[model samples]
Target: MQNEGEWEAVRLLSTAARLVRREVDNRLRELGLTQERVTVLRVLAGDGPMKRAELARRLRVTAQTLGTSLVTMTRQGLVGELPPAAEGGARRVVDISEHGRRMLGRADEIEQVGFSADIRPELRRELVSLIHDLEVHRAGASASL
Candidate 1:
């Protein structure tokens, strides 16, 4: 016999995530930014300049995936690649552009207004913990593979 009213945890989480993504994306659209782009901008702004490979690790994405975004972002003037740190060396250092920072600031404003008090602090902490745990599990699984 099956339980009459079992909760579907994964389905609920997925739906909530989709809705939140939609809302955030819509808000970001006003600034000509997407969530992915905003994430890159935030990391660069917060961490300062670094190589693309290092950026990829910080972003939790593969080099090739980040490369595609970098190409478009560079062309769109949201990011820039600088000369090697050494005079006679070769390295790719990237940083967020002024325009990107402006957009990120706007995005921050939108996010602050849109979600500042929606979720309770306890629930938010639980969600964050859950996400961290999942990421750790995922990394361990990938390593095993």
Candidate 2:
């Protein structure tokens, strides 16, 4: 029972998200950073050191996916992992290195510049609000299934 208007809304949102993601990814690539790596850095910066499983949950990705992402980030020196305790050895915890904090600050600057240049300053708040609402609804819809 979907109408043309509904379908158009879906397409518009999908396309806009893809375009935004592509621009961000392209910019990060210039800095030798991947989307997942940037996300890892942001999460660590915000939350501090956390267990691998918890990180995977927060990122809404599989543990294996996170493992692979972390390997690349670790190689890039953006993050570091701590060894298990000699006692009840738990999973490796992750933390952003000092270098990562510097890079993240740089990334934020780049993102702000890109957004200002490409997106209308006036629509920025509404666009952010729309994306947030979509995510909240999507999560609720998924859980109801």
Candidate 3:
């Protein structure tokens, strides 16, 4: 009916996203990075240090999910934490380590190469608009990313 092409477009986008993730993950694996981890690093780099809960909220992930990622990242020396009592005495704050910053730079390079496909400018604009619209539509006014 009215949703004939819509479903196929969404399915294709989903499939393409998964394929891109897989390809990028494989490349990032060599640098001890994943797209998810890179995203965390990027956000920290942009927003500066933030409490654990705040970071989880900004990333739109559960605290428990972020906790697991933090464990591994902490062990890898990619992130540093300031204890609650040591800082404002509230909650632990997380920041990207210098190592994480350096790795993020390398990851950016790898990602650039991976996404080197030359899409038309119009297509790029459409893709961005589509993503923004979808986020707004799905999450209402809270999708400010």
Candidate 4:
């Protein structure tokens, strides 16, 4: 039901997203971090400690996927699991460590230098608005289902 222009736009957006992700991942690899891991760290830095289930939900990934990432992060000492806030609680809380915060700060600087320079300010704002609108619509559609 979409026109050629619409299809082209979708393709361009998908390709651009993948390219950006690849570039960011490549840069982060030097620091032994991935974009996903940085995202988790950023969320934890901003939101404080959170239950694994809640973190998984916010990340829009399955618990198992997040758990796998957490396992690696834990072993690396980038994150730590906290004891349950209440006895017999099923949820495990995860918090970013001081090292994680340092890494996240470095990641932010890297991203700013690597990513922000490529996009014009106006275009970046427009893209952000478009993505926000799409997310809002997607959430509404999901809620209706």
Candidate 5:
């Protein structure tokens, strides 16, 4: 049902997304982390402690998948599990460790010298806005179906 130009736009966007992830993952690998791990750390660092289910939702991953990553991160001391408060039930909370913060700092340094640094501010803003709009539209479409 889509026109040629629309299909091309989607392909371009998908390719761009994959390329960006690849580049970021490559840079993060130098610090012994994947883009996904850094993303989890960054979210915890910026947002404070959060329940695993909520964190998984925010990261758009299944809880099972996140649990696997958490296992590795926990063993590596990059993330810490906090005891559930007496009143808050038994849901475990995850927080970034001091080591994780240091790792995030390193990741930030890498980002500064990475491809993101070359993007103009205005262009970056436009891209971000477009991505957000696409996400909202997708969410609405999924909900309707």
Candidate 6:
């Protein structure tokens, strides 16, 4: 049996994550971006050009999953494959297209507006702090694992 504190923590995290994801996705959708695709774009934007495997790692997604996403995005012209970065197997570097950047800008704008209007400044600061703490804890947990 779980302790009340432990149970409440889990429940709170689950509910909050679901709600946040839904809102973020809704905002992204308004800009013609899906959550998965937005995630891919964000990873690429931060990491610079990357191959599919690298992208999968950064996104915490499987290669197969990222591959399928890349295929669709490629078809949609959101990203393009260039010469591979490193050795062995085609480098297959992926970069965001001009259109993808525009879409990302719009989605980011929407997120900013929503966060500023819907969430109180104090709550936003607290949430950011909590997320930082969670990341520290998660790193420690992963190390132990």
Answer with 1 or 5, whichever has the higher lDDT.
Answer: 5
Model 6: per-residue Cα lDDT over 1-145, one tens digit each: 8664766766977876678778788877766678789878877777788777878987888999999988888887888888754556467789898888877777778777764357778987988898789889999999998
The lDDT for every candidate, in the order shown, is 0.87, 0.85, 0.87, 0.91, 0.89, 0.80
What is candidate 1's lDDT per residue for 13-74, written digit by digit as tens? 87777888898889888777888899999999999999999999999899999999999899
**Superposed Cα deviation of residue 70, candidate 4 (Å):** 0.9
The TM-score obtained by model 3 is 0.80
What's the TM-score of each model vs. the native? 0.85, 0.76, 0.80, 0.82, 0.83, 0.70
Once superposed on the true structure, which residue ranges of model 4 sit more than 4 Å away at CA? 1-7, 86-90
Q: Which residue pairs in candidate 1 have backbone atoms (N, alpha carbon, C) closer than 3 angstroms, thus clashing?
A: none
C-alpha lDDT (0 to 100) for residue 129 of candidate 6: 96
lDDT of 2 by residue, 36-121 (tens): 78888999999999999999999989999999988988888889997788887776899999988988987888787874357776
Per-model root-mean-square deviation over C-alphas = 3.1, 4.2, 4.7, 3.6, 3.8, 4.7
Ordering by TM-score: 1, 5, 4, 3, 2, 6
- Tell me the tens digit of each residue's lDDT in model 3 across 20-76: 788889999998888889999999999999998999998889999999999999898
Candidate number with the higher TM-score (2 or 5):
5
Return the top candidate by lDDT. Answer: 4
Alpha-carbon deviation at 96 in model 2, angstroms: 0.8
lDDT of 4 by residue, 1-145 (tens): 7654757777978878898999988999999999999999999999999999999999989999999999999988899988875667655899999999999999998998896468998999999899899999999999999
Q: Rank by lDDT, descending? A: 4, 5, 1, 3, 2, 6
List ranges where model 3 is wrong by over 4 Å.
Answer: 1-7, 85-87, 116-121, 140-145
Identify the leading candidate in terms of TM-score: 1
